[model samples]
Target: MKTPLTSFAGLDLLTSAVIVLDAEGSILFANASAENLLDSSFKSLTHLKLTDLFLNGEELIEVFHQAVAHQFADKRQDLTLERAGREALHVHSIVTALDNPDTPVLIELRENVQQLKLDREERMLDQSKANKELIRNLAHEIKNPLGGIRGAAQLLELELPERHLRELREYTQVIIKEADRLQTLVDRLLAPHRLPHIVGDVNIHEVCERVRSLIVAEFPQGLTIKRDYDLSIPEFRGDKEQLIQTVLNIAHNAAQALHERIRQGDAVLTFKSRVVRQITLAKVRYRLALDLHIIDNGPGIPPEIRNRIFYPLVSGKEGGSGLGLTLAQTFVEQHLGVIECESRPEYTDFRILIPLP
Candidate 1:
């Protein structure tokens, strides 16, 4: 009663797309992931040739032939595989010569960018949780001592006699001022957690427009805000005010980073939106998602602190509080979305992706 299907049942559980080919390069078997990747049923896929599934099938076929002849394994990186009426996939293809006489070649396709992105997002989610706890405890510890310190300073200032008032009052003034500053910082640290999650259908372009107006008003002279929006994108449900604040923080940071460019009257900030299909975020696959990009023409984030830019109190600019991006990320994540950044000299891009219902 044990059939070929039962023999290869484990392959169906693998995440990577797998296909077995006969000596003539005809598909002998296609696993569950292969069916998902190719957008075809296993029965339909088995009737097709390997060349029919990939845009670069000729190159892959050559690799397969060499692997079968030499009894070796080969890998091709960044190969584009095409599917019927669907977008092409970028994957790393591995060809190996099977030891069996019937099925001679095995092909495995692993999505290059998506797999890496999912891994990064998973790590970020874990790190975000740890950071939240650390910030809460740290803020509480700092906050409790602050009120007492400010109160003591005020009492000392009132008790000083007229003769010593001027000298001693200066010290108390410093204490009270520093205490107030620390209190403000603690408030900011707890701001995102304190806000309510107000959800509704949101027009992404409207959020972009609001951020554009705010950035231009503050910069005023040299910076230009450009919009490249896809009009066909449907409205999705999220927190409107939080989304506006998220985009504004990113744009504001870009504007601040463009100090030299602004002075030269060549600073450019772009807001581009598009629709992405068959995307995965937070380990869940989405049929459709929104891709919003906030790009800037600045010197780019400093290399040293780039990795830790999302962490609290990490800043590239002098006297920067460094909470803007952190809060933006927190707000986006609350909407079951993610934000990613890529930066280099003269070009810095911040991408925010949210699932569409």
Candidate 2:
């Protein structure tokens, strides 16, 4: 006679990770992906409690309890899973109560990094489109009246009577100057949209090197820029100049944020590159992707603006134009990639993932 495990053999063939739990939260079954994800065989996993596998197990356990009590499906995003002697796994988890009272909960987990990236990219693209429309409309509205205002100021300056106009000319000059400044701001806002995306074979290390050289030259005194490159990453098709600027913007921001650390001679910035396999970007899966990280030992991004850092005109730094990250994100997205950030008290990390051909 076949055992109960044979009845659910179909679940083992699924790519997504699945785990079944009894009413007491003990593992009843785990699929193949669950085995690989939890770093344990089905036989071993069955002996463990479901909570034993998650870093935030208590919270998940509560979710299981709630699901059982309410008899409803519950879901959590970006849940961290605990494993022995390994990095925590990030997954999206769904818990559903089983009809059988013996096995009361079913858990489904999927690796969430790529899905999160894809969702973020979609949101960014939508936001970027909206911003472009707003900028175009606002630019036109401001630009039309701006030229008239500047011209009027110039004509007033030219028509001023010499004796009475000396001090008054300064007023006209101020108007022209402020108008010119606003014009420059508008131009910068429109620059990314105006540029042609010129594609070519891109060596990521070369981009990193160029950005490093620029940063070091600017902050030569107390900053150290380190390279942790995986030389195995191959050249891919992209816009070299755009990539250079993207890396430069991130490095430049890190350098600026390291002001105190730079003064203390302890500023450290690292450029790390590796090849990520089987990653998805904007809902498209790629066999390989270039994972580039720019990390810094600085004060980290301010908490208030962390969520909106990628939004246009949002800046953490005083007097920052706030377009650097916006442009960087735009350029990367053009290459079918996404950028993400994680920050805390003493560390800040910016990661850019671009799908490889």
Candidate 3:
């Protein structure tokens, strides 16, 4: 059974903080969960401007006014709201205007961060477990077959007549090359999982710098790796080698994808890092986060396979094994981080977010 709206004094969902405000920005109705979140009751908070309740109240009110006036099409905005105990909230706001414009009511929803924190930990654990299973199956099923293929190709090379041997050798060489290629891919896919994280104080900028130099050395003529770094971020404990590999894989993929643009002398790969506080990813929450964005000015990811881009062996490039980003994702998730891709024509950005120590 469910509580009726007339009898139910609190919000039905524990996951969100729901509040109903009039066009004048007066707090008209708050469900029980919202009261619990704001640390105030409807009786005392009625007719009070929401901004007056916190440090950034004025800005919040201004955004709310603009949202209502414009009949805001975007459901997302950066907000700093507060709860009753004066706990500062860094949240993403989703606002909806009521049908009646004269008495338009706004709904502001906030996530219950305590649960978000717990969910993050759980998600990290789950990702680690899944990665282990993936590596194990792929290594046994895909890697183990390479040796036989290469051996068979070698045997076939010796059996052909000398006059026809050139073509036969070419065919054998193709088989051996492809088998070796697959072998290298399997090694890369399983590399992160096999090595223990060598945790030490690491300067993230140094890691980025190393990747930049490597990319420049490989593509000296046309491609350029640009740095847009926030140098103020302090050193944190992490595996220096793993971080290098994690970033190298993504940048390498981007470089390879920009081959045409590089030839045309317009290729650009940008690395940007910033400190973010109170982030929620994959439905989990974190107190402090580091956001690193890898942007490339190239053709965007194809729409049909964009959602499945992160899966193992899924590549947008011909001759690509598609395990580079997968391994990078595995390495990052080992550090309780996430890698997400957003691509559009003329621009593609791969954003990596990790918790700050």
Best by lDDT: 1
Can you give the TM-score per candidate against the true fold? 0.72, 0.72, 0.60
Candidate 3 lDDT tens digits, 165-214: 98779889999999998887778777776888899998889999999999
Q: What is residue 46's positional error in candidate 2, in angstroms?
A: 25
Model 1 lDDT per residue over 183-236, tens place:
999999999999889989999999999989888789999998889999899999
The residue pairs in collision within model 3 are 10-32, 38-84, 39-84, 51-57, 116-285
Cα displacement (Å) at residue 307, model 3:
0.8
Cα lDDT over the full model 2:
0.87
Residues 1-357 of candidate 2 have per-residue lDDT tens digits of 323766667898888899988778888889999999888999999999977776557768888998778657566656766666787676888888777677778898988866556666787778877866877787778888999999999999999999979889899999999999999988987887899999899999999999998998999999989999999999999999999999999999999999999999999999999999998777788999999999999999999999888888889888998889988988898998989899998899999999987
Off by over 4 Å in 1: 1-93, 96-111
Worst-scoring 10-residue span by lDDT in model 3:
1-10
**lDDT over C-alpha atoms for residue 263 of model 1:** 99
lDDT of candidates 1 onward, in order: 0.88, 0.87, 0.77
Over 4 Å off, model 2:
1-115
Give model 2's clash tally: 0
Q: What's every prediction's RMSD, in angstroms?
A: 12.3, 9.8, 13.0
